[model samples]
Target: MAFSGITTKFTRSLVIKMAAILKDRCLRRIFKKIDFVRKPLRLNFVTDNGQHSIDKLLVANRGEIACRVMETAKKLGIRTVAVFSDVDEQSKHVKMADEAYHIGPALARESYLKMDKIIDVAKRSQAQAIHPGYGFLSEKPEFAELCFKENVIFVGPPSSAIRDMGIKSTSKKIMSDAGVPIIKGYHGNDQSNERLKAEAEKIGYPIMLKAVRGGGGKGMRIVWKAEDFDDALESARRESLKSFNDDIMLVEKFVESPRHVEVQVFGDTFGNTVYLFERDCSVQRRHQKIIEEAPAPGISSEVRRKLGEAAVKAAKAVGYTGAGTVEFIMDKTHDFYFMEMNTRLQVEHPVTEMITGVDLVEWQLRIAAGERLPLLQSEIILNGYSFEARIYAEDPDNDFLPGAGPLVSLTTPLPSRLVRIETGVVQGDDVSVHYDPMIAKLVVWSKDRSSALRLLTHSLRQYNIVGLSTNLDFLINLSNHQEFRNGNVNTDFIQDYYNDLFPEKKSLSPDLLARASVYLILLEKRKQRKSFDDIISPWNLSSCFRVNSDLSRKISLNDGYSDVEILLSFENDDSFKIQIGDNVMKGFGNLEINGSQKLLKVTIDGVVSKLNVVEHNNTIYCFSMEGNYKVHRLIPSFIKSKCEAMNLGDAIAPMTGTIVKVNINNGQTVKEGDIVMIMEAMKMEHVICAPKDGLVENVYYAVGDTVERNSVLISYLKEDEKN
Candidate 1:
């Protein structure tokens, strides 16, 4: 078809425009979704009248999970109601709720776990649904049953499913019957101590004692020796009863060096189930996960398929109809045995969401609203690698001892499209004794495992917290470990690489001395400037400033584990020199303000170092690329003498907790290493031992009495000052 030049030009232009339209980025993405993703997961499933069945949701719990749920609910245009204990009224979750109700006191038993109180609040607030965000009543069959009776939607599995999966013994039996591999153990109703001990011996030593209804590492103990079986059983039972309100116990052979791999599965009321993927939660302390990632590393696609199928099978066996995790213990060869199935959302659910690009909470809400599965198993694609490092207010050097304190300073890695900071508290908030010590869950993702891991460690370094010991440094070290980078991980990772992870502090570096000196000098000038009209005023100056000579002063600071001494000299405002041992350096520093974040940048002999600093209670925190260092100013002897004298030989409460057992009475003699008392704090027990062999002069707190941290629990008679 011959045509004029103008017609040819128009024809060519039209073809070009068509080609461009097909290649346009936005259109390309839409076509990709049509071909690959099929359809994006969304919440537009309204009823026939364009109304959601659940208009308001009452979160029957507290902490990060509660806040997380509220966020999703709000995104779906659902009003959220939060229930809090007295101590949690000021918590982040409470503030995020549309309406909040104070349930009871500080103890969880009297508050969050009071199903009746929560149900009452739900009905009073006219909440159409109750989303028990993990822990508390999330797995309680009675709570689900109560929600059903009250005609409110329970955003979890059916009560029967909860009853079946909530108990490990029942869940194990069901898994075994369903042809899922089960581990060797006794899951029968033999609660007698004698029977358990006999079972442990028969199953052989090195058995695991787990609460029948336990989750989150609560009520779990490892008995390595036959002699320790009874004690382990008793302790496990006590903790189980306190945590789950059920003292039933289950025994299983402790799988040595196995990886704790779990698959995230979602089910709907219409009998549809899909597995998102699997997460490796093998690196842990106290048998609780510290870091988790998905889809599990070093896993073959065939094995992955098998894992997903088995997890789906387990969910089907229980007729689960919500978000649930099927946990498995995988050996070195990838052979796996079914562990207990978490009846609700797992603590590490964020990782699954990251990899699958699906909001499990949103799925729960939709399913509870009578919606079917959003996508088929084949369409649910695993796109990337993801990791979740749980930041906790705990002392890693002290066996990861749980801590309760004010978060005086909290500077976290900024959350992005691929990064999430799952938390329920903020700076200046207290980590209460009546709850979990986890500060937040730092979730990050990338295209591959290595990049995701690098991102994870980088984020952890920026996760700075002050006012209490934390495991941030430990996590950073663990993430960068050689074996971990190579995908060599297991439940014994921490134990296997303990030395590399917890290395002793090296001699205080010159950089540290310079940083500390610079912080003190600038801080002093700032304080003096605030106190008076001019910072340079002669009367306002509190430094070693002199007109004729370079004035020097001896300064001391405690670096958490030891005392660090520095001889610092200065002549003018920016003139300063710091000396530690034979090492010496000169530096001038200034502070940079970015919103609420303060960066202390110091140039020592021309090399500039930027640091995030937090000053609180005489302690100066310096955060750098290397690590976070805390230097506490020592109290001078003059003022120290004015305060009440502390007995060096007294056994003090290491944390705020109730005394669970007192082994020594007044006037009783104790050996140097004897256990003086045991206190329960933050769901873990801390033992106070005799400082030295001496007579117990006083027992200040009895069993069941709560004591403040650092308070003397027992006074030991010193040899020099014996009564």
Candidate 2:
């Protein structure tokens, strides 16, 4: 019986087999016309081959990865050419490169992914090699083919290898033929909806609809039941067409809580290959890896050997050369299956490098220069554990929505023996909505997985980034998770336990509060000194009230969700020591006494911190490393009684976005759940809906206008009045 008006899996499989027969025949014919003869080459870096020296290299991508490639090329005495879209002329990558060329408009399709323009720029610039970083045209076989035709070395795997692995259906067939275990699925070309439905039915409920030609989880859907097949199929097709220009999809059985593992492989022209072991990329959101690590924890040595062997077989099947990754889906049973092969360098290649002391990019360049594999498989060693956390310009609390704007403040702690940060952005750089939201990558290395995790967590907490929202807190929590620390992770681990990962806590402890107060005071003192101002007027002196000629005030703090409250007293302008409930915290520091200027140097548990106090109206604003806190000087009891409520009807735009679709009209009656407007920011659409049934009192702006954070969209009348 047919499901969702789609054909049966058996029929779809036959159609796929038939399509493969035809496609293979066509590919064989095409391959016959292409010459695979090795060219006579002279020694380059090893010997003085001046005529064959590569004068310039063109980077055929954008963003952090492009900048990274340019840095390596520049250090190697090569002139670097950066190709950019109209919107990226002033980008960091463009500024860092030796020369810049405008390819087209901002959209990737019109620029970075446009092979012809990229090739044209290379030819014009007289570049001897083209490096397709990680994304964009990195995996496209045609770009590599063009580079080969023009005699420009493609700093990646051979074009033939890319072609063989580019198509999912064909790649699966090749891997399966090569004896690699593949996940049960139908990798066929029966685009008929009916046929797809049948394949899904065979795969059983909870199947995945995956695009045959794309990564980054684009054009992918997980249908839990047969009834949801048609809608999912359409959605997957639409996304696939938009992302990869290919609507052909395959159905595979969904493995619940499967860990994502991949083995890094490198091959040389001398027919030698070595596996760099495995990296666990299971911590993901929306199928994009957020954290990755090498030498997957909790995995057995026997399993590692099996995975490595499988990856090598998959690579050898396509005659793979240069840097490539063989990804796999491992279930709880420890049974692994081939996912796909990435025929280019991975973004997380640094973690592998940290552990193995191997520079994969340098090896890529050397291999491209006709060098033999420096290390054999037996020589490859799995070293200590390493972890990488991808720092992105996105809001974790807001469903991890992408954030865009000028980076007002960006600072990372210096790299040490255990911590490393690879970033391409600088202060004042604008994070545009047109590209990926990643800002940098923070990597840490240690002798063991537990130690590596601990080091990474500490580094994240020490990192300070202002302006745009980030996943720093979430990452820290994830690193400390028991499951993650124990290395018992899978692709679904985050989704299944996200709520527990980010817990809602209220109010700081008395010691922490004391520390925060001191830190704020110090910060204010520094600012005042910088401004060379004394006795700053309008500073809230009432917040620090005097009792019996002593400049000290009693303050009450409460846990918002509970009735628990704690009282503590602080001196406004005196060095004081206090013992509260077995905790001895002291406020002692050099004080520049001035009217209305209250500063304190406090030591909590032997660690000194500062605090600054400023008064506005009757409220005191305290700024510290903990966060901003406001307290009333007149009514100290009110501090623990009620916290200020976040105002509603104050529709704040999620990010620095443009109003793309304005659906509400002024004075129009709308019910709750109605979408009033939609904003486009960071390449994603955000829908603003009415919070309750009410009449729209006003429309704030029109379409095509840019909006900042906290910008009001529309106001709604009271729910009772609307009814």
Clashes of each: 0, 15
Cα lDDT of candidate 1 equals: 0.85
Model 2: per-residue lDDT, tens digit, 650-671?
Answer: 3568777778678888889888
RMSD of each: 6.7, 13.6
What are the runs in model 2 whose C-alpha is more than 4 Å off?
A: 1-52, 86-91, 510-516, 519-586, 589-601, 604-607, 610-653, 656-690, 693-723
The best candidate in terms of lDDT: 1
Candidate 2, residue 262: lDDT: 96
- Model 1 spans with C-alpha error above 4 angstroms: 1-52, 527-554, 560-573, 593-597, 638-647, 720-723
Flag clash pairs in model 1: none
Top candidate, metric TM-score: 1
